[model samples]
Target: MLLILSNKKQLLLQAKSLLLSASFQQLSRSSELTFTCHKISAIFKQSRPALFNNLYLAMSTQPAKDHTEGHKIPFLLDDHTVTTVRESKILVILRGLPGSGKSTLAKEIEQKYKENSRLFSADEYNIKPAIRSSDGGEYAKLDEDLNTCCERREANLIVLDDTHHDRERLEELFDFANKYHFIVVILEPKTPWRLDCGQLKDRNHWKLSLEELKNLRPALEKEIIPLYFGWFVTKRDEDALRKTSQDFLEQLGNFKPFKKRLQAYGYEDKHKLDLLKYFGKTPNILHCTTKYCDYGKVTGSEEYAQQEAVKKGYSKAYTLHLTALFVTPRTAGARVELTEEQLSLWPLDAEKEVMPKDAFPRGSRAHITLGTATEVQDVQTGIDLLEFIKLQQAGGEREDMGEICGGRIHYYENGMWMLTLPRKIELKTIFSGYYGKAGVSAPQRGGKKVLLPTCQVM
Candidate 1:
């Protein structure tokens, strides 16, 4: 009986050990699955954020809710939605250094857009990947291919995969986009090690050295070249200015001398001439333009953007005192009296370029264009300002048209009028650059869309 009891105890111990082993294996398997899930989640989060968000909501303990309403996912839009909802043409320009995962991102974008997307890669054209291209032959061919793609309108979305470090190259792409009426979206890789030269050296397909990678870093590190640089007026100030400018226009319309001048300039029905429509609202941020970079296509633009003064002043706020309101047949603007600090960011040759013969001080041509005449471009505003300065310097007869809007009005020949204010109009503004967009629209303010005129400097 004692032997049987001992055997039973041993059997019980063996059963308990087997049960523990089974439990341990099960736990190990669960942990492995959890880790894999996490890895997959991370990848999806990066590649397909919208889809991942939906999946996460579905898998949550709470009830799944559709945050997107009825609109389909960007990648999975139905035929009806594609035809009606989306922009007809889009050019996605992937910009980054080699090994920065630009190509990877391009592939993902192409995959997301599916059959509607077509990718044009410089590598496919046999152009070596570098900050600067040694040969123009392959690049020219690549441009031609892209041009053809744009001409054909073959795809809803066209992806260009390349370093795109050169501003000139980017300008060419912008030109293609403009010609094709395609919305241009520049995308840089979100990889943490994108700018890490050492990592890039190892990861790059070309096996470029650390030195080569470093050489490519400077161009990417520099500030993005803008279509133009200037002081952006605050919304509040802009509204006030708009009202003041409208009032001034009304005052000018009623003034007989101004009417006579308009009549002399072929505006036969001077009384009927709508000055507001004659000088349409410019669709741009109301600011005094400092330099028109033209997206680095202009000579010395890149250098001007890279200046120490420009770098320091960028996005910084400063006060501009508007001393006068001036109007020409081409443009209407308020002259900005730049402080010494503001003058530091002003291009030395800005005024000289427009009036090379005169030795006007820096910032002399600084003016915030309120409006431009029909068919006249914004650049004409600065030229008009210079012309006014030249007339002022030449001691041209000033017909004192008396005070309008609490300012002394002086007519300076050939439909050029100036209003010198009793007190300077002070404006708060931030120094910034304007990159071209699909439309001339400002951020929504007070639940209403604020539209700005397109900066048609180019």
Candidate 2:
């Protein structure tokens, strides 16, 4: 799926709708949250940032803080910087050597807050010098930047990926957290995944040989291994990251009502809604305004007036369907009138509509005299008549999609259009009495039925 990050809703909804209709394997629900991304960064971009910042305050929950698990999840960062955040912040700092599974831990943070957080990566913004391992200055700048971001007062979940060598550098981070009053969790992997650096040498994708690390390994160990000195714990698994983020948010607040508001606005019960609320309340339109405005039923059931189309012993699909098309003049305007015969005989412009010259035709006594207005009938036009009292159900294609010849016209009530179908042949004759040219015909809908409001000059 193409990423359309610019219009979040359009991108997410359309993609979700499309995906729901298809069958796929190896699905990671978070990745499927299809939204197109623009290069521009607003406050809300970067993984439901608004929600993360509000992790501890904005939303309030029922039992207050969730301490059932015995301990509050810790927040930690390795950069020597400080900061504070509001309601729902969950800060995680991952410190380890390059191959010690820091990225994997970072990914777990994203999965934990799948609805509310996104992973911020170091490699993505790694300076050119850092990429080639040629300059220490780039890494220093990056460390400072990461430290500064961790100090933010609005981060929902900030996970830092870096190496710590001593208390001197860690002090820079501790000092900031002290001023900002943000909690820091110290994390260490218990069962780190070990990779055979040598194995990468023989693969088609490898760019180096097994002998290369012999020289570089010393520098890496000096900068990285000392950082894990006494704090080595093997419990920083994927589950650990998830449990930590969830516990942090729960302590911050209960988000159910907020979730309801989002659901009403058609937002999925996820982190997007939590962020959306934090950003500001979004207005909700009537459900019909949605692109696919499908209700249980709209308009009415229009079936052909066919009884014997299907014999008692025959199939139901064979039944003739007659549509009872009831339409109101979207625009009630004036027009000239002319009889059918007069219209046929007149030298009128083909483009302009010519009404009946005579309001009431010779054959019927109950003629609908549309004064100053005209009702022109095509072969598709017909009328339905009910017994006892004559009820007319107009059946045919409307002249214009939303326009009608002017003079006088009907209006629909509360946008509700109803129709009564006839099953037997006698019902067809009853309709002919009121309409004169009575017949059950199939419905002819012009243009697609759109959710946009009906347009009329009046």
Candidate 3:
């Protein structure tokens, strides 16, 4: 990565340092560090001639043995690639509560497009004489099977029918579609939902009455909760990140450009930036987001919630490596380095929401929010990270005005910049999931739960 520098001398120095650090990391992981260095050299050669000069000189001095193995690194997926994939296949996601007629609509849609469409549902994955009880494991398996159907179904259109009432669950489906290059169309049943399944002749096809669907929360089920899965930061690491961010903000307050901007904003005392007061404390829930599902509002979220991989990996603990600490006037945060295993749960287009598909690769903004400006949402932290990285990618130069006790500070345009830490910080974190407020209720296990007429899904 070509981090912006204030001057030529610092640029060369930081470039050398960055390569050495990457080399060490690569060496530790495998014998691929040398090739990675060469790739960096190539990137710099094309985008940053000055820095490449320094890197080339340094690489010339290294032993030839370092270049023994070479591997071609793939480029990021561009719009053309995604567009072509989407053109070839499409995915239709059906959403609604049971008895909302989701199945009937899915069947009709599939039949109408029979020549090009195929339908998949959780009911197909259920065992013979399947029980009606809410079970996480069973749902997990069904999610996996549904995903498999998406992957292997030989058709231009695939329809997934289920009670996809939660958003977080739907995000998973989008993730799958991204991987497979399929376009997603969500269809919610329009018919009014009735309480009963109307006494199906099949004994195994049991349905809950309106009363049973209004009291208890369903465990491990996608319909009841809006779950967000991510990597949580440890207490110690979070403290260190917060301290670094605070110091960076204080230095930012001292910058002449920043001071002038503050004056323009009506701040006479611009020498000391009240970073703590200006930017509120970091959120209590510190995490590197893997996915954000807005209660199944996002396309394909319901299928994602039931995904088997997510279920099995839920709540597992892993070590997170902090690569850099960055601060902008709007936010302060840390960029996390995700391991291969961790990447499996990461949403393919997480960064694309803020930056264009060609601008940054997937997961480029994976970060922990340390703090945010007044009235800013916590999610802005990742946006700030993308802006910082984008500037570096463009070989945009900033002023290396000073340094902190823990890192070096550089000033970019618009009161945005980053503090590059001298050392990578590693913290132990758990792979936890989140469920927002229960928008709907389920039947109590042993009691007769009260029914609400409005309790329906779509």
Best by TM-score: 1
* lDDT at position 101, candidate 3: 53
* Model 3, span 1-458: residue lDDT tens: 33433344454555566556654224434435455555566556777888677667765443222221211000012332222222335566766455445566676656656765678776677532222444335457766765676667667567887755444555666666545544444544433222223422211143555444432113212243244567655444444555555555666666665675554333664566665566665554467777776556666566665676655454345677877777677777888888887777777677876666556866787898877765677778888888888888999988886765456667777767676767777765545444433352211111222222221110
Error of 3 at 199 (Å): 22
Residue 1 of model 3: what lDDT? 30
436 Cα displacement, candidate 1 (Å): 1.9
TM, every model: 0.53, 0.24, 0.46
Model 1 stretches with alpha carbons more than 4 Å out? 1-194, 199-223, 437-458
Per-residue lDDT for 333 in model 2? 10
lDDT of 2 by residue, 296-382 (tens): 111211111111221111100011122222221111111222235223322222221122332323221211111111222221011
lDDT of 1: 0.68
- Alpha-carbon deviation at 21 in model 1, angstroms: 52
- How many clashes in each structure? 6, 46, 16
